[model samples]
Target chain A: MRIACPFCGPRGSEEYTYLGDATVRRPEGDAPSEAWFAYVYLRDNPAGRHRELWYHGAGCRSWLVVERDMRSHDILSVAPARDMALARGRAA
Target chain B: MLAEKYSIVSVVAQALRGQRGWKPVWREPEPRAEYDVVIVGGGGHGLATAWYLASQHGITSVAVLEKGYLGSGNVGRNTTIVRSNYLLPGNIPFYEHSLKLWEGLERDINYNAMVSQRGVLNLFHSDAQRDAYARRGNAMRLHGVDAELLDRDAVRRLYPFFDYDNARFPIQGGLLQPRGGTVRHDAVAWGYARAADRRGVDLIQNCEVTGIRVEGGRAVGVETGRGVIRARKIGLACAGNSSRVAAMAGLRLPIESHVLQAFVSEGIKPLVDGVVTFGAGHFYMSQSDKGGLVFGGDIDGYNSYAQRGNLPVVEDVCEGGMALMPGIGRLRLLRQWGGLMDMSMDGSPIIDRTPVEGLYLNAGWCYGGFKATPASGWCFAHLIARDAPHPVATAFRLDRFATGHLIDEKGAGAQPNLH
Candidate 1:
């Protein structure tokens, strides 16, 4: 698995730390219990490529936007979480 | 695979017996003469490295030595959370792979450690932050991953306690890493130790290395508590104690020891079911399986192996968690303990081919130690067994500082990442 961070170079996965999946939208207060449940406990566990968050705790300590294959452990791309959303419109 | 029925008692019992249903692998001392590889520190990284070296690469004659119990150091003291939402490219892919390994570890390593895919949300405040999450989410999607930028409404809906509507530090949004979750910190280390031991790796406990014997700029063997153990190759998996060990071989590293603390509240009705953070909130919290609200705040400002933090951090952490989830104000704090963090000059770890030969390192993890255990071993094994830099670790070269290619993550100062 290889991630291309905006700041750091291509480091082994060990340098960066795993945060989790990327699509979970934070629910506003007073949302339904189901929204809270989905937000807290539910996960897609998709088999194809997935978006995830990672921190380069060992490296830059910045949040990373990583695209990875659930089934194959193949990384599609890696970047800072800050830039990931805007780049969301344009798939690299 | 772990039995569906599990608890700390069951886990500890099995570990003490070394599993095959009996034959306790308890502290029975065994004399060993030699091995193919000798790895110091029985923490997760050491055990994992031994596992990869033996199982993945077929290098079976190996030994892992621990000064205390496996994970006795910083590994066990961490707040276990696995994540790959990084700001660096070189590291994202590897951790993503580690996340993949985590998903299958129960089966692959035959350890029932729950790799719960609890989501993690890093909240934001300003438009700049929203854009950051957006970019990160997009990058995740581009790399075939899943991430999305949430709006204020989305954030409020996800975390009801957050005061998104507040005028100050208005809830702009956040970056959610759902694949992230926690694991029993000790189990991860024991799991690797168990698997590696079964694969014919010698795991010597309480065998503290007093000195690293080097010859001709090559690490030759180690002087242990009992006696000197000779080996052709060696690895330093001592995260918190790395600077001391590396110094034994006359290698100077820019690692500083910083104390980190975590607190657990009295068992109570579950409030927060998953991990959530408000960088603005100054705290993060998640209820464990038993309903104890377990969490921690940022790294302690100073250095020490005191195993206790200053009163300021305790107040700061509680205040932060309370601010994020005002509902937990009544929950009593059960205990708080601190661990040493080997903070590197470049917040990123140094896994380079150091000036000394036959020596490899997997330190400088800061607060992310527990999460990156697997990937650290895999990459370190590559560096040790193959004598070449794994593509991702090439950026962590020893000369990065001298060359001014620091990969800085400490936004407060110099490049934490050696660029």
Candidate 2:
């Protein structure tokens, strides 16, 4: 699988580190156990198009939100995670 | 027709009769309305659970639902290495119990599961690692499990073909468990399935569970691709898909799915006698009866439901293999495949009751599921039948994480990939 990093062009998956589902939001400091558990462990494992975080450790060292298909290894889109977070009015 | 018992006399008679007096190992049953216990996923753990539930608890009204064919999941995908060398208090007893069960599995199930007790060797490269292994070996001895701390010369005499003089990560010593070895991965599933079937448990294949039905905070039934099948008790033994299936009942588990790849090299003369793990890297290799070198390394440090892995892990594994056994580099790569691992928070498994009544969980087996098959099945059956945790599995509670009672076996903390 190749990820088109925002900083580095299409690079092999070896150059990046995969952090699971980009959709999970960390719970508040005093949230209940359920909230924390969900944030830490729950995953949808969607078969179709999904968003995930990949760290380009070898090249530009930038965090990217890669939209790829789970069923088929097809990269749909890629953008900086910070930009995606700010666009959604959330903290990076 | 009933399956015939396999024996030398029966085999000779079948040979004399043109070898046609055989029956299907297990019946392919159609879905029934309800059962006393319904186990989701027809892998090794699920089949073993059903077998124990009937043989021990006399709960014969059980159904094992499989999304695919039996033994097509991780049960058949692992590297087939079995061992009981563990350090933690929660894991040593459980795995030791599993090793004992593996020792008697073939006779107990009346099947030739190809259980070879050759032993397992974990090499140490540095002085610090030797000390750590010494501690673990002592812990195993304390638990009455066999463990031997081999010195550098002891290891050299046993396997002199290793890269002993490697400038980096030179050979120091190892921890040996004579009872640790390998088993026929697919045969285990078939043996358990046949035993469970003989005890009147329905073995349903190609039946995918779509949703879990909960009524008044209790699991009552499941909606599958076939139809609605009700059950008094349900067990979620779907290793990689634990999170997805548990979500059907509005429950979230502390599991993340990651792909782990295993590889085999071209058949050659028997090389390694037992399982050997590289101390410097995440590579381990053992020879199969067919002469193929069966081995695997770390899980692809990512969350993936896919059964295929990227090239990076492939390269990394090959490098580790060559570093340990350079002669294998000349062998041709025959085939490689991946299995989704149900990685847990602290690297330990969970075999406890879920929050929803009548629903039990048996998952979070990062790298130890195959070795834990028999014990996992026995303890899970106990939990389902008695509605209480077994004595050995008391620490694998679902609420442990909430109470900060995590069993960090590898000290990997909360990262699933690290485990």
Candidate 3:
């Protein structure tokens, strides 16, 4: 499969690493047990289109926005997260 | 000696050559049918993908076809270590999200997938390794991940028995990642399967894929054991056999199979507290909560679906681990297992669209598949469900190999100590 990363450009699926389901958002502290479970392990497992997160570890080592068909690997678009595109890691 | 034989090499060798009871008989070809979505490989990634798709995106009709039981592939064979202290901007965040996901996986999936954060450390003896650790620690700090640089004294404090002043591969200090740990690998797949199954997804076990029925540049369905299950879309989570699986669609993923072995010592008193990796020793060891020593080493440099590897890497790993922790040298290894690591040329992962219209891929994870389970499912699910790449995984595309835009992480100065 072809993955179009933001910094590394479009590369083969072999060059990137699949992290996991990106939909589960870990709610900040103080959420209920159901909310925590939903954020932690709950998922859609959609049969059609799904929005997920990926990492292009073989290239720029950047997270990728992989828009693909769950029924098929037909990718529609690839980009960075809403706020993370501008976030660059710094040396501690 | 660095070049010697391991105890359980014979069994693994037989398993690889189709001698043992578990040779993979790929599903034969059959008529195609059309369904909404189909996920190949019943490993952790594929099952998690199904779970995410059905639960998050409201894509109800999904099928996960596994060549074997839930995680009989690399999922079951991996050395279930979990850490997010990556130096790369992309990997650090992606793995950090995965680490967070692991903390609550058991409760979330309603399965006891023992995710433990017992701390992990990468010992640095050389100036170059130290520099790399500093850079990596900085990246972790930047991403709000818990990481720190420990001096030799701190290292000695944490691990007193380690020979701090050894003449060979001296331990100067280490980069400590307190949040890193291990999990029950097989349980991860089972837990995800149970969760997905509970949410109304059909998991067809022992269903091998003979061919990807693609028509007019689109994936029509798959030929499986239960006959042709027409899938509107397909996700390839086949790791070790990724190349063969993709070839059914007439595509060759740029992946080279490498055999990776892991060993476990007879249950002894817990001699180690956390995962200890020798930066220069090409070895790493982690004491399971049950007091067994989980060990692994560098990837056996060869290409094939041969799940068994040569004995040299195993010996090297044990040598390195023993060199660092001399106190554990007397413990006998109970068993050792080998798995095929679907190693990509660039030493990363691929999660994107294929040339075929209806097929997506999430393979070529190399030796890091276990830790990236949740995140891989999330990204692959996003790519399949929304028809768009997540903002985070923008770099790993199939075209990168063709264009020479590889994310080579196995080269010199790589943040991963084992490589």
Candidate 4:
């Protein structure tokens, strides 16, 4: 599968390293252990649409949030993770 | 009554009678309104669980509900390699028990599963890898499981066709498990189903469990496509869809489903005598009785429920195969298929009671489920029948993830794909 990187155009999926579940946000330093456990281990792991983190290690070396269908491996959209985090009111 | 016992005399009698006396292997039965135990998923593990529950625990009032036909899941999709060569204390005993169960499976079930103990060898390419394998082999020996460390010349003497002289990643040695090999993957489900059926366990196919009926924090029954069937106890043996099914009961599992692909080449003369794993890469291969080279590599390294994988993994597996044995490059691949793996955070499986009362789970198998089929069933049956964790499976507690007692076998913490 070829993923369209915002900076490097389209590249083979091998160039990108996959880290799962981009939807998870890091909890505060003193957050409850339950929150930290969920952040570290739990996952929705939906069979349908999923937004995941992919690092463009072989390309622009930037982390991208790639929205794709887990059932079909079809890429729906791609954006820089920092931009998405900023837009979601989280610190970049 | 139980079906006719299979033996050499029975085979000859059947041949003389033109095989007309052979009955159906397992009976088809309608789901009853209630059962003592209800098991979700009719794959190898589910069927085996039913069999063990009936035969060992005397809990014959059991039902196994399957969404599809038997052996349609990872049981049939796996490459069929079985081994107990492990390192960790929590894993070695469990898998060793499974291996011993495999040794007596066909006789116990009265079915020819073709359980071949042809040995499994893990090749080492470097000094550090050799040292690691030596440590693993020593651990297996300490546990009374058969393990042998072979030198480079010893490996060369057994299999002379390897790319042993390659400048990069030259073959150093191997760790051999003589009792580890392959079984007929499909026959495992069939045999277990028939055994359980003979013991009065209901094998219900095409019965999809849509929802789990939870009454005041206890699972009472399940809402299936056919009808609501109540049970005193419920066991979830659903492998790939463990997280999804558990969600039906208002629970989330520490599992991520990833697609793992297996490939087979066109039937040729017997080449690979036994299972061989490439240490430098993730490829493992064995020759089936039909002469097809049954092999597989790593998972797709992504969260996916799709039963199909991308080309990158296929290419990577082929590259690993070529690097190990150059001769296989000439052979064309005949078939390739994928199965969803319920990869757990610690790369180990969980077979314990959930927080919800009367609800048990048997999931997080990752890539190791096929080999651990019998012991998983045995342990799960013990758990469901007695409401207690099997001694060997005590480490697979559901609360371990929350309690900081994770059995990180691969040392890859909290990453399902990495495991």
Candidate 5:
């Protein structure tokens, strides 16, 4: 699998490290324990069309939000995770 | 009709009768309208659960529903190595129970599963790894499970072919479990299916559960591709697709499905005597009775429902294999396949009732489900029949994630891929 990193262009998947579920947002410090638990443990784990976090550690060293199909391992889109977070009004 | 008992006498009699007297290993039965219990996924665990429910719990009115044919899932896709060498108080007893069940499985089911107790050796490279393995071995011995800490010379005596002088990770010592070994993976499914069928449990194939029917917050039945089938109780042994199936019941699990690949080399003369694992790397290998070397390394380290893996993991596994045993670099890989692992947050399994009424869950096995097949069924049967977690499986509660009682065996907290 090759990830077309927005900054590094196309790179082999070996250059990137996988972290899961870019959709999961960190809860507030004062959030309820149940809310924190869900944020930490629960997952939709969809079979297709997953947006996940990947770090281009070997090349550009940029964190990317990769939209890929879980069923086919097909990369649909890639964007800088910081830009995506800022666009969603999440503190970068 | 009940299946005939398998014995030497029966084998000779069948041979004399031109093998025509032999019946189908299991009957192809139509789904009943209702059953006392319904088990999803006709893999090893599902079939074993059906058999135990009928034989041990006296719940013969059971049905095991499979979307595909029996053994089509991870049951047949694993490397087939079975061992109970585990750490942690919560895990050792449960896996030890599974190992003991594996010991008596062939006789109990009257099937030759080829349960070979050759031994499983985990080789350590560094002094720290040796101390860690010694601790794990002590834990296993304390639980009455067989474990031996072998010195480097002892490991060399067992298998002299290892790269003992590798510069980066030289072999120093190892941990040996004498009772752990491999079984015929496909026969496990067939044997359990036959035993369950003889006990009057319906083994329904090509039955896809599309929706789980619930009434007033109580699970009543399931809407299948064939038709709706009701049951007083439901058990989800569908590890690969656990998240999707549980969603039909309005539940989300702490599971991420990842692809784990296994490979077999071209048939060669028997070389490796038992299972040998590289502690520094994730590679483990054993020679099958067919003379093929069966081996695997880590999972692909990503969330994927695809029953295939990337080339990078293949390269990584081969590199590890070459580093440990350079001689195997010449062997040609004949076949490689992937199985979906239900990686739970804690790196352990969950075998308890869901919040939904009349529903039980047996999933989150990660990549270790094959060895736990028998006890998984045993505990899941106990839970569905008695509405309580089996003694050994109490730590696998569904609410443990919420309650912060997670059984993180690898100490890799909340990271499913790392586990």
Candidate 6:
């Protein structure tokens, strides 16, 4: 599978490290144990159209959120995860 | 009714009678309206759970609902290796129990699973790797599991064809377990299914579980393709589909499904007598009874529900194979298959009750699900019947991750793909 990285254009999957389920939200430090547990452990491993986190180790070293179809393995969209986080007002 | 005994006498008698007296090994039963216990996923683990439930606990009114046919899951797709040479305290006893179960599984089920106790050799390269093997072997011995440390010459005497002189990764020594070997993967499913069916457990095929019906925080039944079949307790052994199936009960699991592929070469003369694994790379190989080299490497480092893999993994696996054994490069690759592995955060399994009442889980097997089938079923049956974790599987609880008791066997931390 080839991922069209925002910074590196297109690259093979071997160049990137997979971090599953980009939708997970880390809870605040003062949050309850259940919230932290859900954040740390729980995942929605859907069959199609999954947004996942990937780290480009061999290229631009940028963290990306690649929207790919899990069933067909087709990459639909790729953007910098940091940029997406900032757009979502998640960055500190 | 007396179960058919497969023996040479029966074979000869059937041959004399034009081979017409043979009966079907298992009955294809229609799903009943309700069952005492329902096991979703009719793979090896599910069927074996039903068998153990009947034989050990006398729970005869059980039903195993399969989304597809039996043996269609990882049970039929694995590289058919059985070993208990583990290094961790949390995993050693559990797999040792499974290995012991595999030793007597044929006699217990009265089926020829062809459980070959040849051996398993983990080849080590550098001095550091040799020490690691030594430590692992010693740990296995501490757990009362048989393990032998082999020198470099010892491995060469057993298999002289390895690329030992390669400068990148020179072969030094190995860890050998004589009792650890291979079993016929599909026959295990068939054997367990027939045994469970003989005990009046319903083997319902093509019965996809669409939802888990939880009533008042307790699992009451399942909404399947056939219909809503009620059960007193439900066990989820759906493997890669564990997350999706558990979600129906409003429960989220710490699992990500990844595809792990296996390959088999065209029929040739016997090359590998037992299971052999390379130390430097992710390559393990064995010769099938059909004279084909059956092998597999690492799992595709991506979360996927698809039962297929991309080309990169294939190329990487072939490279590992060539790096270890150059002679295999000339052989034609005959078939390749992928099985979805339920990779846990700590790379261990969870066979325990969920927070929801009457709901049991047996999943997060990673790539070691096939070898753990017997003990997993036995322990899962114990948990379901008694409402507690089995003695050996005490550490494999769903709450372990929450309690910071992760059994990181490979020391790979929380990364499921790394484990």
DockQ (C-alpha) of model 6? 0.76
For candidate 4 chain B, the 10 contiguous residues with the lowest summed lDDT are: B1-10
Off by over 4 Å in 4: A90-92
In candidate 2, what are the lDDT values of residues B1-419, reduced to their tens digit? 45777788888999999988777888888889999999999999999999999999999999999999988999999999899999999989999999999999988998999999999999999999999999999999999999999998999898999988788988898999999999999999999999999898999998999999999999999999989999999999999889889989997777778889999999999879999999999999999999999999999887777888889999999999888888888999999999989998888999999989999999999978999999999999999999998899999988887778999978877788888
Candidate 2 CAPRI level: medium
Q: TM-score, chain B only, every model?
A: 0.90, 0.99, 0.89, 0.99, 0.99, 0.99
Share of native interface contacts present in candidate 2: 0.42
lDDT of 5 at B191: 96
Residue B296 CA displacement from its true place in model 5, Å: 0.2
Please provide TM-scores, in order, for all candidate models, with all chains considered together.
Answer: 0.75, 0.97, 0.74, 0.98, 0.99, 0.97
The window of 10 residues in a row where model 1 chain B has the poorest summed lDDT is: B410-419
Error of 1 at B329 (Å): 1.2
Global lDDT of each model?
0.73, 0.91, 0.76, 0.94, 0.94, 0.93
- CAPRI-style grade of the A/B interface in model 6: medium
Put the candidates in TM-score order, highest first.
Answer: 5, 4, 6, 2, 1, 3
RMSD of each: 17.7, 1.6, 16.8, 1.3, 1.1, 1.4
Cα lDDT tens digits, model 4, B281-382, are 899999999999999999999988889998999999999999999999999999999999999989999999988899999999999999999999999999
Which pairs clash (backbone N, Cα, C closer than 3 Å) in model 6? none
Stronger candidate by lDDT (3 vs 4): 4
lDDT per residue for candidate 4 within A10-66, as digits (tens), equals 999999999999988899999999998888888888888999999999999999999
How well does each candidate reproduce the native contacts, as fnat? 0.00, 0.42, 0.00, 0.77, 0.92, 0.77
Q: Cα miss at B386, model 3 (Å)?
A: 0.5
Local accuracy of candidate 1 as per-residue lDDT tens digits, B1-419: 22232357777887898875644433333636666688989888898999889888888778788988777887788878787776666566766767777877877677767777888878888888777778777766665555666777887787777666555667777888888878877888877877777777888888998898899888888889868888888888888777678878886666655668898889987556568777675677777877888899876543344556656678779877766666778788898898877766667777766778888777777777777888888888888888997775677766666665766654433322221
Question: Local error of candidate 2 at B67, Å?
Answer: 0.9
Which structure is stronger by DockQ: 2 or 5? Answer: 5
DockQ of 5: 0.91
